[model samples]
Target: MLKNKSWWSQTIQCHMQNQKSLYIFVSVLFMMGVIFGAIIVNTLDLNQKNGLINYLGYFFRQLKENSIAEPSIAFQHAVGDYLKTVGLIWILGLSVIGIPVILILIFIKGLVIGFTVGFLVNQLSWDGLWFACVSVAPQNLLAVPALIIVSVAGISFSLLLVRNRLIQHRGTIYPQFISFSFLATGMGLLLIIAAGIEAYASPWMMKEMIPQVSWITVPNGS
Candidate 1:
């Protein structure tokens, strides 16, 4: 067991060492997307802000009334969404031209997250902060890292293909492809755990927190 564990650890260390720059670039890009998303919230017109606020208020009322989907259904939907993203990234890694698209997807993921959290905090103040802590942070703790790792792996593989094509290098890509596939599989497992937290634990926490946040007023007749 120790031998296998050591081998796995060494393999991961080697990959990280080799792909250090790619990791940094992908991470920075995702953070830039997140910051841009937050800025977008600040740029919203009064009418747009009011529209979103009204929609959010209605959703909160549904949440407070216990009208949300069942945990099983939520779990299924979350798993499907997570897996689709993973699958797309894995497929993209196989194509040299897909690198840009992969990067865009990672950025979009970060943007969505930033927007959701930004909106919550912008409108709810401290309550939004607390609510976001419970609702957004939990699953994202796993999901974000999984996504970033997969994004790096995908970009690295695509770059390898690009380099080989440009230089006419005759090295076999089979071994690296295997490693990349394994990494995606591992990330998929991690995302499943994140999905479980999102579908079950997050909602439970949100329900527990809704009443405690004094400013989340439910609409009349809700």
Candidate 2:
């Protein structure tokens, strides 16, 4: 009984430690989002903003009828995208020097998202807002969480590699690698689901919403 209690205690401690690590890594992603969001807000000019407004209006108007995409094509695109993302994570996790680079990649991803949403919100206001919510939010609900998990796992594995190599820490690399691979595989599946939603559900949702939404008029060449 005493041994069982000790084992349970150790398991709890380890679980807590893993949770803490995940939180730290996710916080890094969050900080990246904030920094990139600010950059988008600061760098966009009037012409660019106006162009974005027109583009968004046109895109949404078209979305009402033209948003249907082939499911197989969507699946392929989604799988390809997942491969690109997980490939980076896997490659970066293998190298000691890749830790910072992986973080930077995560930052760039956040930047792109922030910029896209920011532009949409700034240009169309409510129309842009609802469009983004319907079109972008659905897939991201699955994809982003999967991304964050894989990213955190990758960062942790990379840090482990760094510590084992540079800091001369005696740690098991093989098991960690297995864990990382499994995490990536699971996340890849989740991302594929996200892609399915993006291709089929998101477009459908946008098409449905587009007819109902009225775009706020933009000034000509403003």
Candidate 3:
């Protein structure tokens, strides 16, 4: 009886450790993707870079100039896009085969964010840096953490499914599945709030910061 108890304790500890390790590994992979994206943005040629800068500048300028702001419309669109991702994570978390795909999705999300920030800072210098901090930072403050948490939960649940199937564990998976669903639902709600912030608050912030952008001036003497 004592031996059986000891074995059970060891098994539980091992499972906990594996879950922790999985979270750390997934986070590292996402960060690596972000770094890779930054590198890609930084390596573009001057002409292409200039084009990108022009497009971004024009877009920002328009946002600043436009007096009629429709934050509700923006919120709907943002929430819809975010829900697509939330849905993917929800559906994928149940299947053991989804682990890699979910990880890839998380990485891609991080990459996009990193690329946008890196491009802004690289192209605009200090002005771009401030713009990024003001416009990008607020929404992502909610979004990035929520995404990471959902990813960790999804990956962990998928691994649990794998362990149950591979080891032929006798316990029923219904309880675990329910728990996973609840975790995902909570995370989804957080993402909705993030979408709201992105739509409503981010634009206002950008409009305020746009005036601070210093345009390059040519000297007649040159």
Candidate 4:
């Protein structure tokens, strides 16, 4: 156990030493995407805003009616989605050209999150803030870090490939590829946990809170 701990510590230290800049860059890029997404909420015209609001209202009604998918089904779907995203990132890490695409994927992930939270807070005020905390924040608390780590890892591996092709032509890439695959697998596991929280915990919390919110109308029969 101690040896494993030490190995992990050394690995992390090495990663930080070599890839700290990439981590900062990826994190900043994601935050920029998030800010841009929030700004987009402000740019929507009245009609557009109203349309989104109506959709949200409908969703909330469904939520209040407990018409949402069963937790098991939701968990399956969420796990599938998370797996696909992680698998894509892992694949992207194998190709040099995929670096930019990996970055874009991370940005889009952040943008979607920011937009969801921003729209909720803008429309619902305190209630929206509460709802976002309960629903959005839970899964993302695990997911965002997992994504950022995997994104950085993907970019780093792609860069390594470039270096191997251009600077050092004699080395085998199998070892590095194995390490990258392991990292991706670990992050994927973390995302699965996040999916579980999203599927089970968030819905339960949202359901409990829905009745207290003044804005979401309980549908006629519900």
lDDT of 4 by residue, 1-222 (tens): 999768766876676678899999999999999998998999999999887877777777778778889999999999999999999999999998999999999899889988998999898888898989999999999999888888888898898899998778767888888877877887898999999999999998988777656565433543
Question: How badly does each model clash, as a count of residue pairs?
Answer: 0, 0, 0, 0
Give a tens-digit lDDT track for model 2, residues 70-185.
76787788779877988888888787777777677667767777777777666557776787798778887887767777777777787788888779867779988886786777
Off by over 4 Å in 3: 1-18, 67-69, 214-222
Model 3: worst 10 consecutive residues (lDDT sum): 213-222
lDDT tens per residue, model 3, 1-222: 999668645754554465787767877887888788889897899999877767676676567667435889888888888778877987888788887888899889778877888898887778888888877788778777667766777777787777888777756778767766765666677788988888888888888887777463212222
For model 1, residues 1-222, the per-residue Cα lDDT tens digits are 999678767876787788899888988998988898888999999999888887777777778788989989999999999999999999999999889999999899889888988998898888888999999999999999898888888988898898887677767888989999988988898999999999999998998888766465445644
Better of 3 and 4 by lDDT: 4
Candidate 4: stretches off by over 4 Å = 1-13, 216-222
**Candidate 3 local lDDT, residue 177:** 76
Task: State the displacement of the C-alpha of residue 98, model 2, in Å, after optimal TM-score superposition.
Answer: 1.3
Candidate 2 — what's its lDDT?
0.72
What are the lDDT figures for the candidates, one per model?
0.88, 0.72, 0.76, 0.87
Which candidate wins on TM-score? 1
- Candidate 4 accuracy as TM-score: 0.91
Q: Return the candidate ranking by TM-score, descending.
A: 1, 4, 3, 2
